[model samples]
Target: MSLAPSGFLNLGAQNLEYRMIGPVPEHAPTIVMLHEGLGSAALWGDFPDRLQAATGAGVFVYSRAGYGASTAVKLPRPLDYMHVEALEVLPKLLEWIDFRRGLLVGHSDGASIAAIYAGGVQDHRVLGLALIAPHFIVEDVSVASIAAIKTAYETTDLRSKLARWHKDIDTAFYGWNGAWLDPKFRNWDISEYLTYIRVPVAILQGVNDEYGTIRQVEIAREECYCPVDVMEIANAGHSPHREAPETTLDAISEFANAVLRDEGFRAA
Candidate 1:
């Protein structure tokens, strides 16, 4: 099925909202973007447009179930929510989008989902990955930051701000927050998946990211036999695409161009 330029994609029991920029997947190499835990398709701001302009590749951004305008999920998401997203949801989404050859560009939880998909699915259509501030394992810093966000959501205007992007604001925020804050989630790990990935990887991390330390990058290097590239963005935090747009765009565009070169993909 040919996807509308921007609309809801009906996948089984849920409808995921998405935006498509540049050429269609069948026309050019696609860059599928997965947003952060608290992020929606709209929360990605203009980064998708900028990425399309920079790389000259089709960019598809989507809101997962329970986020943005997508269907709301049940409260208290499972500890392996990322795994479900990667192993189940993503495969169908790709098939529906007609994703033939492309790179997965994901941020934070989205990045983890991308990594899990790349490692677990073994879909040859996925040529590479551009992961921004991904978490391979839960860390003390990640938990502390999540806990602090919960406080801000309850006491401050954070909820109102996030509500603009998410239709079910509380569901989106708490689903991600609750999972990370759950003590059982401390055992959450996807580092094992890295060993199976056959594509090149580009990891763009913020120098002072509050949610995760450099250890996340270390784990990818130690586990993946595939070529891995790292770029630490200075004066930026966890959301480098938002915090450091130009640098993030340049790095990702360069990587995408290089990996998708065989498909005759180019960068602007």
Candidate 2:
């Protein structure tokens, strides 16, 4: 499916950069994509397009403030930044985009943000959740990996690579990195939110994920009262959507279609 030109949304003090894939048919669902930490709309590449094609849903990909072409944010972001995003920003953003109801497809930090929003807000617009490599609780491996990434940013070409996606590289990187590396952040967990999620959840995690373990999925299964579908991809780590795009896409696409086909289910 062809796409319209990329556009920007002005939300008071901030500008959000976004791209729409396929057409936003009034009768069809819209899949809003929340990118990973240190990732932007562009980093998602053609995944959104493939998803749109596979599920026949409109796809919207956007970069949060301080990433990509969006406005830059202050340093030392609050430890509850993700909470702020899910509770405050996401609702406003969806309203801004005129999102009536659809699936939220989030990766990594984006996934956590999606879960938080679904649990916190009682809005029925959120039909289902497609969380890719999500983190509900902070893990030791997460901290260790983030620390290694910090070293890479300081010594390797990772910063240069990230420059291709972020307009304010430092703001984007440090905002996420600093928040996660903070000692107090170790206690940061959104497991309680999972208990409130009533929508069907599609979780895809890489078996060899370096940043998080299968424990993340385990937490979701244990806490969520709704149906939880999981895909543990082999030979993929941290980012199954990037490392194993086909497998990941197929799983989410199937789930979305199944939910849409069911007449008795409601999105909450």
Candidate 3:
């Protein structure tokens, strides 16, 4: 466990604790794992370790503001939290971590952030990308499933399960669910930005994903001009890495190896 000294990261007017794993000074490319909407670094469990072991790449996993070990926002999150995440917060995180290039393995909302970040880059450090159950635009299935999740949160044992992972589950849940469910959010799309990515990409989408459609990954591939290999894991849910860890990590291992090979740095 090569976890870094966890500490607060000052990002503009906000601060959140960031955790790092693996070797320092970047002897190898890092794969940053961005958590799901309601997820924190703690929720990632052992996936990061598996990825590190397989790829020999140090992993950076952190909870964003208002989730996990990070501090909650003093005020209400704006309706466009995705934009806030992509434009304002993520860049600061990259700078704070002292990395110039690497892979981004994002889940759910974190995937969206990675897309936007890579798309926005000039001389970007992103060597490759892996999006797990990412969403570029909301799909009806997503809206429906999220609505159902909300129902489960109130009426079933889901909240208790979530509470075990999140100290303020409401902050984590509402911050993600409310913004996506909001009608105005339907118009959101990052298709235009994906074209800017020069790195290879791998998109993992479940055929039965709870909150998205296959077309989302298709559009990302098309717009980015890189046909990222899409793996539609049969019977997998929105969290394929959780549902099918071995399958998910196998794809990730392939991408990381390819990237390192392209850069002439074989995995040790």
Candidate 4:
């Protein structure tokens, strides 16, 4: 099916809200962006547009189930939700978009999903990965941060603020929060998938990130046999793309250009 520049993609299970920037995937390499746990297509703001301009590639940003205008998911999400997204939902989304060749650029939960997809799917069309604030394993700091956010959502205006971005705010917030806060989730780890990945990987992390620490990066270095490039953005928190747009964009653009060079792709 032909994807319009911006619309909801009917993927049978659910309809995902999405936006397409620059050329279509058939005309240029695509950059499929996955949002953080609480993030959505609109939450990406103008980053997709900027990324397309910088890389001269198609930028596809989408709101997964229960976020933005997408279908709302059942509450108390499975601890393996990211894996489900990576393995089930994503493959369909990419095929629906007619993705040819591209990189998977994901942030936080999105980043973890990207990693799982690259490692587990063995899809040669996916050339590389750009992971931002990815979590390979559950960390104490991550649990702490997630628990604190649950409190903030209850007591502060964080809920109202996030509501502006998500259509089913409660589902979007609780689905992610509940899963991470679950004690059983502590054993959740995807590092095993790293050893299977065949493409280059770039990790852009915030030095002051509160959700995760440098250990996440260390895991990638330790597990992946492929090239792993890391850039720690100082003074930034979890979301470096929003916190440090220029540096993040330049870094990702450079990575994409280098990876796609064999395909005659260049990012100015």
Candidate 5:
């Protein structure tokens, strides 16, 4: 499928890169995608198109500041950076897009940001969340894997590979890497926000995810009062969307279709 035209969105001091895919009918809801820590709008490849085809919902994706062609940020990002993005940037994005109501498709760090927004923000337009490989709380395995990635970025060809997608590779790498590796970040947890999320949540996780364990899924199920569905795909690692696209797409499509059928949420 051909890609839609791309553009830069100005949100205060930040300029975020965004891409819209599929046909956005006058009344249908849009799927706003949030990339991972090291991911960009380009890195998402054609998954958005596949999603659009599967669910018949317009797909919108954006690269946060410091990633892709968006604005660059300073290194050694704050421990509350994700919170800032969730509370500050996301709201601006929705407004810029003129979002009526839709589902949030977030991955890894992006998922955490989405969760925080769904719970913290009073906007009832957000209908549901499709969280992929989310981390509600810090874990030893997560820290160890992040440390290994830091070593790889410093010694291996990882930086060069990532440079193709990001304008300021260092800002993208260090901004995310440094924050997660900081000792003070160990206490970082968004489980408290789960109690506030009233929409349906579809959690798609990989059984072999190197960064996090099933504890993240357990936390969501235990904390959320909404109907939470979990999909643990085998043989997939960190990114189930990239590793097993068909399964991931099917799960997301099914969930979105169900949401579309809800008469309570009319088309915007």
Candidate 6:
């Protein structure tokens, strides 16, 4: 319920700010929850703990650079942050935290990262993956929502509220929003990589999601070679886990429990 004192994780060339929740249990593999673009350790809210309580697996949640309290990402982020998170940052994070194997619950940008990592990385540490309202392709809804968010932040209290959770709200917002809106970002595609993922993956998308449509999840389901499950939560938006944590957690728990069964791990 409370955040512990902030700690510094040495990311080779630089230090990244990170925090922890619990060692949870080993019933299923660990569930590493990746936050949205605007999300941080604190922004993950109470969902991780609730999920751990339900599934009895350790939960790892942290902020990516330029979000939450992590170090600033100095370079101009290529349109595919999912690739960067998958190839560069996540591997280092696993090594930094010594996370050997687990399930991943990623939302929004985090979901894209989870997908990329599950598919591209040669490491088989991931047993399963659950993506909440994930986006593999850019759509009009995504651009519209982002533009609306931009307008609101410039005119409303959204920026101040976000600042309470992020040290540099402006930087985080711009870094994420600006890149996604760029013309070159439209060509971003990770479907080629998705075909390589062999683990069980559950894709959860809000039917009314403002950022993505069913087409995205449909594409993922059709292309992914892994065991793919789809759950379309009705009447929700981009932050499916935040807006409806219980349903999202239940779907994630079921997928992880199934994986545990496959591996003969005791979930009961």
What is candidate 3's CA lDDT for residue 156? Answer: 94
Residue 245 shift from truth in candidate 4, angstroms: 0.9
lDDT of 1 by residue, 1-268 (tens): 6768899998999999999999998888899999999999999999999889888889999999999999999988988999999999999999999998999999999999999999999899999999999999999999999999999999999999899999999999999999899899999999999999999999999999999999999999999999999999999999998888989999998899888786676654
| Worst ten in a row by lDDT for model 6 | 20-29
Per-residue alpha-carbon lDDT of candidate 5 for residues 19-125, written as tens digits (9 for 90 to 100): 98865523467899999999999899999988887777778999999999999887778899999999988998888777877799999999999999998995788
The runs of at least 3 residues in candidate 3 whose Cα sits more than 4 Å from the true structure, single-residue gaps closed, are 1-5, 74-76
Clashing pairs in 4: none
Q: Global CA lDDT of candidate 3, please?
A: 0.80
Name model 2 segments beyond 4 Å from true.
1-4, 25-27, 263-268
With a 3 Å backbone cut-off (N, CA, C), the pairs that clash in candidate 5 are: none
Cα-based lDDT for every prediction: 0.94, 0.89, 0.80, 0.94, 0.89, 0.79
| Model 2: per-residue Cα lDDT over 77-118, one tens digit each | 999999998999988888877786688999999999999999
Question: After superposing candidate 6, which stretches have Cα over 4 Å from the reference?
Answer: 1-6, 24-28
Tell me the TM-score of model 4.
Answer: 0.98
TM for every model, in the order presented, reads 0.98, 0.95, 0.93, 0.98, 0.95, 0.92
Between candidates 1 and 3, name the one with more favorable TM-score.
1
User: What residue pairs are clashing in model 2?
Assistant: 209-238
- Clashes (backbone N, CA, C under 3 Å), per candidate, total 0, 1, 1, 0, 0, 0
Q: What lDDT tens digits, residue by residue, belong to model 3 across residues 83-134?
A: 6787777777777777755788999989988888788764367788899998
lDDT of 6 by residue, 1-268 (tens): 2223357777776566665555532323567888888888888878887877776667778888887777777546667677878889888877766675678888888988888887888578788888888878888888888989999999999999899888778889998998888988877777777888888889888878888888898888789877788988876777778777778878888788788667665543
Higher-TM-score candidate of 1 and 5: 1
Write down the worst ten-residue block by lDDT for model 1.
259-268
Candidate 1 vs candidate 6, lDDT winner: 1
